[model samples]
Target: MTLEGWIVIGVIFLCLVFLVGTTISIDLVLFAGLAVVFILGIIPAEQALSGFSNEGMLTVAALYIVAAGLKETGAIHYIVKRVMGNARTVKKAQLRIMSPVMVMSAFLNNTPIVASFIPALERWSRISNIPVSKILIPLSYAAILGGTCTLIGTSTNLIINGLMIEEASIRSLGIFEPALVGIPCAIAGFIYLFIFGDKLLPVRGSSMDTFQDPREYTIEMIVAEGNTLSGKTIEDAGLRNLPGLFLIEIQRNERAIPAPGPYEKLREDDRLIFTGIVDSIIDLQQISGLKPATNQVFKLNAPRNERMMIEAVVSRSNPLTGRTIKEGNFRDRYDAVVLAVSRSGERIDQKIGDITLKSGDVLLLEAHPNFVQKYRNSSDFFLVSSIEDSSPVTYDKAWIAGLSLIAMVVLAATGILSMLQAAIVAGFLLLVTKSFQYSSALESVDWRVLIAIASALGLGSALQYTGAAEYLAVNLLEFAGDNPTMALASTYLATWLLTEMITNNAAAVLVFPIALSLSQSLGLNFIPFAMIMIVAASSSFSTPIGYQTNLMVYGPGGYRFTDFIKIGLPLNLIVATIAVSLVPYFWNF
Candidate 1:
């Protein structure tokens, strides 16, 4: 091997060491490696910065906006509500979550699907009395397994396809081409999780379960007319088991039912009273069919979607302390309407308008985002703070967002437009429909992931340009002793090991040139090798660092590092075996 080839190999080895041993961000680490290669003059400037203009990376960026649109419009939340029905056991809950998520991930991006489900599953765990640790891993793994089924499912697949187009000069893969092997692997994975998930997964409690807040506020919410919750029972409506909240009573047509049963059905305009901590109250506020009982929420100056939830404590020196909320005209004075009140860790049962203000009373208010900044230092309240992720959802535009996504998928699958073009069109549709603000679309893109992918692509280009990949491929073929099956297995093993150590997309990019070189040396078709790369690159189940989704669930699930090795290692072997055996059969060597 030449001096430049050896240098490239050494730089990549150091990159793996840092990625595995340190706490540095993946993007920064990979970018540093790319910079080193560029500085050494191993590759030209165009090759070094080529990844930023790659179609796959830009498609991933555009897809983030599309996912943001779905989230802002509450479309994903609506689907989760309908599919996550009652589950009596851990296995049933896993089933309920994994089935839809797997199908959804086959077409949509995997990261957003896991992101949307994490909080929902956390709440569901509290309600169902199931430890969150058992459900979160399955949520992430399901998305990963499903992403292997389609071209647009995960960024790794898209990156590989892009490399094929630009480097191998081959046609882009069909949308459903990977499904030939991916479906079998997904089915096998589902079966494994269903049968062994309960015994293999841990039972640790989540952060929400261990923490107890003393302050409880009694809040009243009404079932909107012609809403989904009107005819459903309390249990069916998902109101029976809020972790920190209790359904105290129901008021319908001047009649009160105390301690409503789980089987009790709700009617239109029925006012339900609940006493809970602030966290659970925030969850309740986001439910689509429920509205605050007080009409003041609707009378606020700012639009509902632009408002935020704020907690403020009343001071003794405040002028309105001696008067009831209605008598003092609180909304007119503060430009915020009080939704719930808690005093000395006790629930205030009086109606919101009838509750008399008291010193040190903590009020939950619905107001504009500027409310906190405007009164942070004022004597009107002791402290003012806005809750994170408390902005109201725009449920009215959900259909528009859903249809835009469907149109993008149809256009791409039908070959009417390239994946990048389709994603951009979908994002534009979302912006013009006002489903979410443009600022939100920009915020939704994970810039770090994009940077990591682009930098990794540059490193791959360095390997190919310096002849390092071909040298490595020659050694790999020598190890396989001229056997194509063994060569395929060797490539899959190397890619899988790399994925478990680094980011999946980075692993795929760094290994791609070598696989391409291996295919060329063997005088065989590259299709099978490409298929194996997709499967191997995505099979990142043995560790949290290997995949973004795995790391996402780590803290929430309260998982140890070995927790993944214990349960995920076996699944990784299962997927690897299925991919190696099926790829040659489907695509031929």
Candidate 2:
């Protein structure tokens, strides 16, 4: 291997470290590495930025707008309402969630599909008395499996097809060609998750579980002087049965009542201390006379309805990391009031102003809508996310949005227009028809994912331009000389391994050239080999990092890395087996 090959290997190793070892954004890590290699003259400048203009990348960006249209118009909400019907059992519930997501994911991008479903699943779990932990992982896996059933199912498929058109001799793939192998894989993967997933899945405590977070937040809610609750007994005040929250005590003037009995009478200006999940704070906010302990909230400019509730994970680089909330003047500094703080399954139990902030601490905040837009990209936060249904939806335009999505699929699937062309028209219709606002559409695109995909493409290009990919492919294929099926299996295995370690689109980009080179080396049709790479690359079930949907579910599902390993390992093998076995049959040499 040349020095360039060694450099590519070293750069990829560093990327893995940045992705796994730290909380840095994946986009920054990938772009930073791409810049390093480009500066060192390992790859040309044009190739480094080529992904920015790649058809696959742009199509992904366009599709995000379409997904946003569906969400903004309440089309997603309506669909979830109708489909998630009276799910009485876990299996039935999983089916309800998985079936819709699978079908939607085949036409829509899986990222937004999973995002739209999350809130629905949460709402359903609460209503059905089912643990959300059992449902979220399967939701992600279903999207992944369903994506394999069509060309437009995932960005990775378009990426592989785009690469084939530019680098290989074969014509572009038809919309459903991969389905020959993909449909089988999807069915097999779905069955495995449906049957064995619940058993392998851990029953993690919900966010409100006392055992999960021991240091319960001590929130002081002061009753108004003239409110109806002022003269009522503790039980008569209607304070009990606050889901996931408990009224621990009451404070009146100089007296402290510990664990007040149900009949204990309440008085004006009585202070109530509740210990529970941060999410339940909204319930307290709704109580007519119960104002939060802090007056700082009264100073915020926005009205309650116009503002939003957000959760941000403090990053190491945040300037507020070492300071107390009081010392930092967090409310004034960020125009947001800290409602609660949680750290590693433990809620912080102290006066909101006195607690010190730390990296990885989750802070629940009540802030203006602009707070998210202002600090979403700040380095101080590893993640800044708004809670689901936090923003108002345009219910009237929902059918328009739904119909627009259908049009995009029908046009692209029928080859009346390319996926890219159809997506552009659909995205334009969304904006023009007021189904999605332009400003909102721009925000809806996961630019970080796009940047990461582009950067990974650059890195993949570096391998090809430096001759490293061909060098590696030739040496790797020598062992599977005579048998094409052996070669096919070997190709699937390599691509699958790469996908598990890196972003799926990048994995496909990096492995495509190798798949092509091996095809030529064996004098076999490149189509079957390309199909194997596509399916193998998109089937990223073994690790959370392998797919975006998995990562999105990790925190919400209360999942550990090993949780994915336990469930996803077998499913990964299931899809790999079906894909590898069926590829040669459909596109035989």
Candidate 3:
């Protein structure tokens, strides 16, 4: 290896060290890696900022908006409610539910799907009487499979597509082009999950709770006169949906009924047994239908004998996602009280004491009973034990928020907008529409992932600019000696391994230039070869560390490291072979 080659290898090694060893932001490591190269007087100055313009990065950003929209409008919930709704067995449920999850992922971005579904899936476990450990990993895997089906599905596809367009004048990625093989790949993956996903799943039961479940909810709200609920049937006022509210009795006519008669008229002062999600209950009480007992979000009036704070994520299918804390009546319904919320690394402000909750929004609740129980079965919220409640925000436009995000995705997926343009538009819309909220979305951007991508892209650029890629190509050719199929398979395997250890985006950055270089060196159609690398890079299974969606399940699903290896290895190899074999035929290498 020449000096630049050795330096590149050393930098990669350091990057590996930083990635494997510490929690420092990955973006920082990436920037530092490239800085070392720049300081060494790498190829040129103009190229340093070139990565900012890479189509892959933009695709990632735009996809977030699309995902957010999909989540907001209840588009994904169809799959959640139907296939994933009340799963009984792990494998059966994963097969049924993960199938749609995969389909949705092919259409939407991964983050929102992941963030929205993790909590929902957790809840689904309790309802189905299945252990959460069994399905969470599969949930993530399904998302990956789904993403590989379409060009707009995952960032990896977008990156490769962008590179292809730039280098080969391919115009744009076809919507169902990847599906040519990705469909079969998905079908095979489902089969693989059915056979092995269960054995590899972590079996986390519902009893490992860090907080208590509350008993009663004290709420204050005004009874709307002439409303259908007033002076009608006693059972008509359904408080089951509200949060933090338990109707011991109605304090009306200077009398309280521990239990109101079924035929008795509402009389505008009827109190009902309403319990469950805390935020929904609180917000509901402030509205006209129910008056607050006092004023402060109807905070628990009586002092508790034992109070504990527990954090919980809203499971993907948790019925609690769309409703507010007030609507859920959490306290009265479930005997628990909510204190705060955290979503996408952003806190819920505006007195989350009275705010509605969202999926993936972490809630801090003060309750009783340290033992773990599956509240997810009855409600959409889960009790989290590790992280504390973050601060809150003021933005509140659920419908519009969902819509704005969908717009960006439609444009990009349809090829009306480039991934980069789509991403820039999505980010801008996120800020303008207040979907992410000013304070939270900025904080939620995952700067580490961003920087890591930029730096890795720089390294890839360097390899291409410095003739290092050519040298590597020459070496690969020498090794191949003459067998193109063997060379193609080897290249595919190399990308698969790299992706298993690094983010798919990073792997793409490192692999694409080399793929192009090798294809050119071989005097073969660069498109097919690039597609092979692309498919291989995107299909990194066998490890949770390879993908963010996979890692998100680790803590929640209580999964171990080996679980991924056992299940992912087979799926990974199978997809790799399929891609390598099919690409040459599809693009005619």
C-alpha lDDT of residue 323 in model 1: 92
As for TM-score, the candidate ahead, 1 or 2, is: 1
Q: Against the true structure, what is every candidate's RMSD?
A: 4.3, 11.2, 12.2
- lDDT string for model 2 (280-328, tens) is 5544554445677777777787654445678898999988999999999
Of the two candidates 1 and 2, the one with more favorable lDDT, higher being better, is 1
* lDDT by residue for model 3 (14-60), tens: 87677556655456766888888888887576666566666655454
Better of 1 and 3 by lDDT: 1
Clashes of 1: 0
Q: Quick one: best TM-score, which candidate? A: 1
| lDDT, candidate 1, 47-107, per-residue tens | 8998788766677678778877877788867776677777858998899999998998898
Misplaced by over 4 Å in model 1 are 1-58, 88-90, 104-137, 147-180, 196-212, 442-470, 494-534, 543-568, 582-589
Q: What's the lDDT of the predicted structure labeled candidate 2? A: 0.75
Off by over 4 Å in 3: 14-83, 88-93, 107-140, 150-177, 201-397, 420-436, 447-474, 497-531, 542-567, 581-589
Alpha-carbon lDDT, every model = 0.82, 0.75, 0.59
